[model samples]
Target: MKQVNALTVAAAVAGALSLAAVTAATPAMAKSVKCYGIAKAGQNDCGNKAGTHSCSGQSKVDYDGGDWKGVASAAACAEMGGQTKPFKGMNPKKKSS
Candidate 1:
């Protein structure tokens, strides 16, 4: 039986680590609850998910209910004058194709 070379094992490990790093850098799909009408301008937890922009810091307006912010607690959402239920923004429009 041929024993694995130490250098080959190290190279494989290093390659795996770098791949994990790249995957980790991308945002994970968190179990975040939707908090509506709470996002400050350019401070949303994620985009409208309507292809507006990438997640986080994408909202262009403040308190845009259409643009929900992710939160861990419903209490915190209410404290921030946000609704647990989602709503339409000031200007409702069709999502782009």
Candidate 2:
């Protein structure tokens, strides 16, 4: 009985130490910014910038200026020729006409 108790306590301590080490070694969440006009068809990360939808995969066209994705860096939006703010996004149907 004594040996069992000692083993249980040792196991508990080891588990707790392992959890603490993992927590300490973990990195923080990467910061992301909203980048518009870059998402492909139905690839928007979240809601539409135009308030047209409240769910993911709601975009109807590719490279929608009104839709955005969470980019890791702010410069990525402009580098991709996209806007960080809402713009007059091109509508595929209307643009084709």
Candidate 3:
């Protein structure tokens, strides 16, 4: 009986540790894009139209960490025509294609 009790406790602890490890090991979702000065898809186009020109405005970015835990913020995306920004700006279009 004593051995069985000890084994059961050990198993429970192991199971809990496995669950914690899995949760902690989960990866966050990250996205990357190419942002040209005036032509791109989904990103804000200075003229208000997207999908054909690079973005040149401001937008909000939302990053989800797979488990629904996420973060969001507003950012400014601007550049000269025919130039690509260091990092692609956020897309503000209702739909991204």
Candidate 4:
């Protein structure tokens, strides 16, 4: 009975530790900001503001202002030449192909 109790406790501890590690490593749970006009062609994270597409990775133009991606933060997105809101045309820094 003592051995069984010890094993059960050990398993419970291991399971808890595993859950903690997974939670810590999950980037999807981290803070993020919506960044526009930075995603490459077919690389947007989700739907476009123009209502052209309803899914991820569907943009037909590189650096299109109507599309967006999930970035680490607003400052980070601005640093990467991205806008917080959707706009018309592509990013001036990039030429459309």
Candidate 5:
């Protein structure tokens, strides 16, 4: 009977800890937003607007305007010169020699 009680307590504690971890992570997840025109070649988080690929990390050019990645916030995305909407060309911020 004592062993059964101890096992029950351990399971309850473990469940509570897992719930606490997920709850603590929720706010950070809520803050994330997709920012286009900022991804480097092969570093995008998901599909591009051009629809040539349907997976992450498939971009063929640096700072492709159609690709995006998750940033901390809209403000952060703008601060980094990224756009909230996808575009049809290379990032305007890219410099040419």
Candidate 6:
């Protein structure tokens, strides 16, 4: 019983340390990324830009540009083509995604 208790405590401490290390090593969530647009206008507006036209929401990662909309998650925005200049008012279905 004593050995088991000691082992359990050691394991718990090790696990906690591991978790802390992971948290420390993990990079801060990037503010933005260079993503692609899957639609002209849906939850996001990647079509505002020229050339891109329609994208799969799968573009490159960008750390800068525009403000973030809480409505769109980083992952979701990433799928659309990074971030864009913060939008105002509700987003309407202009071109369809």
Q: Output the number of the lDDT-best candidate.
A: 4
Better of 2 and 4 by lDDT: 4
lDDT of 3 by residue, 8-94 (tens): 999999999999887764442133222333333323423222333233343223210110111121122232222223224433331
Q: Candidate 3: misplaced stretches above 4 Å?
A: 27-97
User: How well is each residue in 1-97 modelled by candidate 2, as lDDT tens digits?
Assistant: 9999999999999999999987874442236778887887788877886788877798887877788887767787677767778677663322321
Instruction: Please provide, for model 4 over 41-65, each residue's C-alpha lDDT reduced to its tens digit, 9 standing for 90 to 100.
Output: 9999889999999898999999999
What does candidate 6's lDDT look like per residue over 1-97, in tens digits?
A: 9999999999999999999997874453333343332332333323334333344232232321322223245577655554434333322322222
In candidate 2 the C-alpha lDDT for residue 53 amounts to 83
Could you tally the backbone clashes for each prediction?
A: 0, 0, 5, 0, 0, 10
State every prediction's TM-score relative to the real structure: 0.53, 0.59, 0.29, 0.67, 0.65, 0.29
Displacement of residue 79 (Cα, Å) in model 2 is 1.3
Mark the 10 consecutive residues where model 3 has the least summed lDDT: 64-73
Write down the lDDT that model 1 would get: 0.70
Evaluation by TM-score, superior candidate among 3 and 5: 5
Candidate 2 CA-lDDT value: 0.75
Question: What's the C-alpha lDDT at position 62 in model 6?
Answer: 30
Identify the runs in model 1 with alpha carbons over 4 angstroms from their true place.
1-29, 49-51, 90-97
In terms of lDDT, the poorest run of 10 residues in model 5 is 88-97
Q: How many backbone clashes are present in model 6?
A: 10
- Residue 20, candidate 4: Cα error in Å is 13
- Candidate 5, residues 60-87: lDDT per residue as tens digits? 8888888998889889999989999998
Worst 10 residues of 2 by lDDT: 88-97
lDDT of 1 by residue, 50-73 (tens): 557777888887777667777767
